[model samples]
Target: MGFLPNSMLIMARKPGLVEAFAGLGLAVQGPSALPDEIKRMAAFMASRAAGCVYCQTHTHHQAANAGISADKLEALWDYETSDLFSEAERSALRVAQSAAQVPNAVTGADMSALKQHFSDEQIVDLVAVISLFGFLNRWNDTFATALEEEPSAHAAAHMAAHGWDAGKHAR
Candidate 1:
């Protein structure tokens, strides 16, 4: 977050991919009915389920920037039983987790649960957040994108407690 990420720096070799993602990133991350914090949470969960340490750290930084509490982030992977999350948050996170699976594990019951808490537009936005991270997770992990300082430090301080490490993405 402090400087250009290695992924973007490398992606620039093919400028068209960067241009395409610029618009898509804005569209997916831009303001909507969905709160930034929840979007960040979904992204963190998606990136984690995808095993992208680079994105996991980035989303951790963004989640903190968006005011997600350490308590919630600490309990993220265990949200199903975490008191820090409400049923609504749990539903969205469930979708993110399921959607991150290779075979796309989302079920009818998952959609129904999401519908109970989010409007149609919000659901789309939530899916978009998860979908966006799907792309980002693959990009960073595939490239072994080096961790940026701010996020790397943050992940070290806050995220390592949850068993995160830079691993192959280490700077």
Candidate 2:
């Protein structure tokens, strides 16, 4: 809602590419069975697993804005055992964590676990959230995109204790 993030700004230079990605972004983020909070949380964790400081800051900021509590966000790394999370949330976050790995660690058992909590369509949307961040993580990390003040501050406030920082993305 503020100024476009640096990734979008860079994408803006290629108008068609930006527009295309925006359209896809809208689709991935559009109305679905999954709530925005869950999707944003998956994105935050995906960005974290991908080790993209830029995306991590941005997604964590978004998750917070979507009403994800500070304590839950802090406990995301341990979602499997965190009392703050539901079984459905744990399954989805597990997918985010594994799917973001370099070799993609998502397993059939993981899918089975997710099926217990999510509909096929909902799973698609959930995976889309993770997939979108997969691309974003690579894009931002490759560019060493400058961390913006708002998201950087948000991450510092909420995620610094989790070993998160501006890192290579520092402006």
Candidate 3:
């Protein structure tokens, strides 16, 4: 069901590339700096903006596993005044939103607001998260990858356990 010649299926043929993307994802969403939960939550929000249903479904599952509440998930789209998120989370979402909106409007005030809640290193990681989702959104949207679709249960299980580094993606 892809726009291109089965690009999703084709990506599976390159597990090394999948692994590489996962590494980047791990670096961005890993527990080393940014909280994996917050990273996944930001990804969910960006996926919504990108209209990538595949990313949304996968990230929704990931966010659930990370303990993101249903209330928070429901309010993610209008988080500016939502009481579900902490100040830190709101700031990160602001950054993610700016990045996801093509021709990003991330301003100095946005950066400053985010910086107040995160270290410089973590800010770098946050930007990486946004960038990754931007790439994922385009790929999923372009390929017309189906939501809830994956090559195999084994692949989904691996990715669920290992995060994006699990060597599987929609496109």
TM-score of every candidate: 0.96, 0.97, 0.76
Q: Give the TM-score of candidate 3.
A: 0.76
Candidate 1 segments whose C-alpha is farther than 4 A from its true place: none
Q: Over all chains combined, what TM-score does candidate 1 have?
A: 0.96
* Position 48, candidate 3: lDDT: 64
**Quick one: best lDDT, which candidate?**
1
Candidate 3 weakest ten by summed lDDT: 162-171
Local distance difference test, each candidate: 0.90, 0.89, 0.69
- Indicate the residue-level lDDT of 144 in model 2: 94
lDDT of 1: 0.90
CA RMSD of all predictions: 1.0, 0.9, 7.9
Candidate 1 residue lDDT tens string, 72-141: 8888979999999999999999999999989999999999999999999999999999999999999988
